[model samples]
Target: MTTPNSFLVISALGKDRPGIVNALSKKILDDGCNIADSRMTVLGGEFAILLLVEGQWNTLAKLENALPELEQELDLTIITKRTEERTPSSNLLPYAVDVVAMDHPGIVNHLAEFFSQRSINIEDMMTSSYAAPHTGTPMFAVHMNVGIPSDLHIAGLRDEFMDYCDGLNLDAVLEPVKG
Candidate 1:
């Protein structure tokens, strides 16, 4: 019988520069670990990375143990945690949420509170701020993947969500995330 692969979640933050991905990927490869999934981006002046890695237990242990040296070599603050593959819940329906508005504070917090109050889970979210074209007005946008309870009333939820967005003066969409 074969043992199941172990999982590790790694988050790294450091000064933005070229070759960070290359170096990080190379290290994972050399350590006999596979990048199962990752999100990498430059946030302000820092490069942020999140990686889900899979490997044999010993291999993952080696990789985890080497993190200190990797941090020093790459000049990153690296954090690692062992994790297991998620067993998705069948009682949840995947939904995508998009919102755009004039840039202001508390938009994310407000949205989070709304979902939390309804027992909905925000699986993933990405937000950005930019200058609007022509007018150069400051604008903010958010995209989120949420898990809505399957037993919930979709029409009611949509109506309520739209009304909430309208009250906030946010242009928003709530729809299924089609695979």
Candidate 2:
């Protein structure tokens, strides 16, 4: 039989600071848990953390109980919950999408809504706004990794997406991701 509560997904969000990672890593190690996978980034002045970890039942319980104190001490907001190990699937092919346009509100929402309506899954996305080198015009850019189901037609999809971008005066490209 499988052991109870042996794996967990932990999320911590707070103001960016110097010691967040170190403190969390030290505590996790001290409690005999292994961090299986993690991603951390600073977004809009807030630090966000995501972690997948594995440990024994008591270890999980201890961490669950101990996190609140750490959260309070560090001024962090955290969520921890049990989860099963994930298995990879090959049903979808990876694609890369890049977008460029003058900075404006609703561009991100529109793109995300378009993908959502088409049942496309975005595995990762990064966006930034910066000034153009020569014109000094504010520009927005997005780079995304998407998973497209094998049965979907690529050419028509890209054409439609690009057409939509064209209406917004945005330049966009979608292509198969290279290893």
lDDT of each: 0.96, 0.91
| lDDT per residue (tens digit) for residues 99-142 in model 1 | 99999999999899989999999999999999999999999999
User: What tens digits encode model 2's per-residue C-alpha lDDT throughout 78-173?
Assistant: 999899877565988899999999999998898998889999998889899999999999999999999898888899899999999999888999
Best by lDDT: 1
TM-score of each: 0.98, 0.88
Candidate 1, residue 129: lDDT:
97
Location of the lowest summed lDDT over 10 successive residues in candidate 2 = 84-93
Off by over 4 Å in 2: 1-5
> Backbone collision count in every prediction?
0, 0
RMSD of each: 0.7, 2.2
